[model samples]
Target chain A: MRDKTILLVEDNQDDEDLTLRAFKTNNISNRIIVVRDGAEALDYLFGEGAYAGRDLSMMPTLILLDLNLPKIDGFEVLKRVRADSRTRRLPIIILTTSHEQEEVFRAYESGCNSYVRKPVDSAQFRDAVRDLGLFWLIHNVPPPESE
Target chain B: MQTKRFAGGLRIALVLAGIFLALASGYLAGIREAQMKASGPALTRDLTIVLFGQTLHLRLSLSALGVTIIFVLTILLAAAVLFARVAHRRRRQVEAVNRKLMREIGERKRAQDEVIQLNAELEQRVAARTRELQTANKELEAFCSSVSHDLRAPLRAIDGFSDALLKDYHDKLDEQGQQHLQRVRNATQRMAQLIDDLLSLSRVTRTEMRREEVNLTAIAREVVTELRQIDPGGNVEVIISEGLVAQGDARLLRQVLENLLGNAWKYTSKQPAARIVMGTCKGRNGKPAFFVQDNGAGFDMAYASKLFGVFQRLHSASDFPGTGVGLATVQRIIHRHGGEVWAEGSVGQGATFYFTVY
Candidate 1:
């Protein structure tokens, strides 16, 4: 399960549920872990707080980050993750409702692997989620694991 | 300017008068010398008869002439002295007037300098105020973008969740519950549309306009075609004149045409045979104005002033669906191009929107 784990950092419960449903409908059966805020995401990433005893070597293959979070925000999370060697090469995708060009530019500038706008229509959103899951989980090869 | 000319005329007149006085005094002195010469022989004859000195008559006449000549010369010298005194007084008066004029000119220069200084200060103040206004506008633009970003998130959540419920839990819910959920979804979608329209309106204000020669006729044709595609069965008659051009941002002008033509199309939906015309005409100010006229459900003239305002609507949502931001966006785009937009309409008759790019 080293590269099959997918961590989703999102504060809104409704969005989290919708995303999970989209993945399930698309048959993306990867072990999915959810963190509610940016700080918790950081804690889980560095193997601290509730995730202290967890093995740091078993890092997730992809991370879905929401920009508007309760603590530290998605940009700061991306920055910190890219700064550390353990999670620096982790493929992080910004999954947000904002289609603003500035936000997209900042996400890519902050080392996000991809940026996707959350569609208001459920069918379109499902399709977008399916495509993303298939592309990152099945098609794209992951970076070599760092010691 | 008149006073300076008058003063110059007076100076010339005084100099001429002084010269005339001097010449007249000289002529009088010459006449007195001639009279003394003519009476000289008679005076000598009278002296010879009275005295036993017939031989001394010439000497007496000569002495008498000398006395007369001396008296005449003294009177002439006195007259000359008086004329010189008068001329000197006139010169002093003219000099005093000249000094007063020089002082007035100095005062005028000071006043003019004060005016210049005041103008400079006012210009500086205007520049500073303009800078302040620019800064405020920038801040407002930043605030608007962030607000739009924040507002869309929750709307998406509501829309997304309702859609999930309807798709996944349809079997568990009753008919009433399903309708309620559908209404919720509809309301959320409408709200989302409103937010998007609001964002576009704000963007119209902040976007830097790129100006170029735009083919207004072509743009109108494109917009009308799109509208027709939207309602493929629409029996509306569209008439577009050729060679309508304007100088403005092409993208923004397209938006203007879209809003105006779209509005005309929507309002005329109830008409059996609707007519829409897009063309150019001379405006009230005699400038070339492009207009979109339609035989639609026109509005009241009294409420025309509120037509371009944001969120202002004359018709009910059920009759016509809109966020009421289209016209406001159109007005903003036109105003950015230094243009004016106004509408004329009569209830149940028709409406026309006119705009001119300066």
Candidate 2:
């Protein structure tokens, strides 16, 4: 069991499943908590609404965000995360289907760690997930509080 | 001078009237004196008769003078009043017409100035909007670059891992496993191509234009010659008019011809004796219009509106292999040159694409 946790905030069900499947196929067993929209992702991070009973100290080691969502959107969620002292330094990668330049600029402006586009093919999708999993899960050293 | 003339005539008439009136009064007084003298005379009847005749003559002359004076005075007074009224009316009419003309000129000037001001404002607004659009396009291109770069990393991984699987697990897996890996590679390749085409299309928007006088005829002939060299089997006769000069970016214009000619070649594959004509024609606005006409498998007229849109393909993938950005890129190039392009075609007939380089 990996000690790190990943929060995958994606609106599309197929995308969420594909992400999970990629991790499972790559043998990356990090605990990934999936949220369907930006609002739920914010809730999980701030320990509000449905996640009120959860412990605030055990925040996710990494966040994979999608720009388009049902409510709140990725930029707003990122802004809120950066504003909070607990999650200010958290590694947030914007993994979205939109290759629109404005979305990427907005993500970077809101203090996102990196931006990535989702590939169309299933095989390429798996590979992208594997590289990210290897980098964050193994090589990258998380902060002391996250550990 | 006019007032002096009028006053002189009035003074002459008044003096004549005064003299005539004085003569008439004197005649009347003389007649009375003669009558009194006749009453006082006791002797000389013949002398009395002579005096009476003299008095009668004087009376007749005085009556004539009185009548003449009244007629002259009335005529002078009437002439003076008539002249004054006609002069006043003529001056008033002239003043009214002059005021109306001046007002009309002022109004026309104001209207023209307002139109000029509105036109200036409209031009300013258009310039500002064009700048905003340019900025947005630049940002979009940047985003496409990021996408292309990031997407390539994953594509590399997919092709690499799949190849590894094929090399290592060749003995363990059967024919079906090899086919699956090949499919994976093919899919990755197609995806890569799509991304690359998108990147190219985005790049077309940002490339700075280098403008110069280009001989479109020479370019068209060159493109056709190249095509002929590649495929010697096609019996396509190319007619290119010479020395057609236009102002444009040479490289971009060359690309435009390449795409258009390349399309002509692909569509005319079925015709045994294909006739391709590249020359200049008169445009809608009386400008020189360059055209590439070919006897090929032309598209339907209904889908002409979609020809310039990015990734808009009229033909199926099986019929034609392209990212559907050739005509779109052509349009962008011509549009950058401040020109326009349009295509005319029928379902089973040939197509002619015309463009203007302004």
Candidate 3:
């Protein structure tokens, strides 16, 4: 678990900092990799563009996805991830600030494992992160490695 | 009107002329009879000289005068009877036509009255519908405030950075500074909640309703389960009757139950043995009604009317944290279902919300 990596796909810098702070305060010491947009997230996942020539077998333990991003949006990324045999079973969780039910339903429909809203309250946000880390990082067992 | 009068005058004049002609014919016949009587003596003298087998000439003249007088009187009487018969027939025809005209006029007047009455009724209906539309328009305007996307984006920025500052720089700030930042965060959160609620209320109005058979019992159970998850320690005894169903937009009805049950959960937090019930009952108007009753922080009856208005609150935020838009949203949903919702409660007792869906 300590050697596992966590990928964060987000565009907003403040949100990224807040999420990083949440992880640090919760004592989650897993390696967190940040990508600024959906395109970068896909590139990192598929070993293309800037992430080319990287080891393909070293996939992240968990993916924290944001819906609103530049170049490509999160839903498309989720679809592409699910389509590929290599990353088909990756545990992807949607973390967004949007409170729209349509967007939430769309995220789930696109094959996300969990959906969490980024609360405006800092305390609530911290608690949400703590609970998420405890469950996904410690308690829940992931799928087997891809052959 | 003028033409009708002229026709009536012409008919009267034609009848009068017929009567006058009859009288004149009678007068001329009388004159001819007198003349024949005056010439009788001359005729008798002449006949006695010419015809001697003239012994009977005086008797023959007297007999011929008698016969001539009788024949003239019979012809005059016959003519008078024929004229009288013609005049009587014409009079009867005129009376029949006049009776027909009178009946037609009465029928036309009645038809005109019916048209006017229908026009008045149409006007009244149009006015009533216009008034209803105006009221709905006003409500829409109130719900759709001018602060849309532009306002919300800046608010998000303020909230996000303030949170960042508080979390990242907490050790640098004094106790007073920390409290100030916390207050700022709280205000921003409250403002965000208000904006979200207003937007949701407007959405309820704008969206079209899709009606389908919805199991209310299942929806209520789901909402209660979610509520229990939120407040797992609260020992609220929730009773939901089985097989309760209605026809409405499933999503919107779910929202209604969520708001109602969420309120029940929030208000009943203080009660050690809180009781909540969701079931169906007969409404005051004898319609099937769904109700949510809770032994919670019930409000005063005097302020009940304000419960469903946007941003209208009977309780303070210190006691119960709310944006005061949940019931307003519920009312909008019920109304969209062509239904009505009302609440009944007393201070320090309990509250029950009743609604009907058609």
User: Individual DockQ of the candidates?
Assistant: 0.32, 0.03, 0.13
Pairs that clash in candidate 1: none
lDDT tens digits, residue span B258-329, model 1:
999999999999999999999999997998898999999999999999999999999998899999999999
After aligning candidate 3 to the native by TM-score, how far in Å is the CA of A14 from where it should be? 0.4
**Candidate 2, pairs of clashing residues:** none
Best by lDDT: 1
> Residues B105-184, candidate 3, lDDT per residue (tens digit)?
99999999999999999999999999999888666644343334334445556776677777789999898998888788
Worst 10 residues of 3 chain B by lDDT: B41-50
Candidate 1 per-residue lDDT over residues A54-111, each given as its tens digit: 8888898899999878878999999999999889999999998775556778899999
Off by over 4 Å in 2: A1-3, A24-27, A83-86, A121-124, A137-147, B1-94, B97-173, B177-181, B188-192, B195-331, B334-358
Residue A5 of model 2, lDDT score: 93
For the second chain, the TM-scores of the candidates in order are 0.62, 0.55, 0.60
**C-alpha lDDT values of all predictions:** 0.85, 0.80, 0.83
Name model 3 segments beyond 4 Å from true: A1-3, A138-146, B1-172, B199-218, B232-243, B268-279, B294-297, B300-303, B346-350
lDDT of 1 at B342: 99
lDDT for model 2? 0.80
Ranking by DockQ: 1, 3, 2
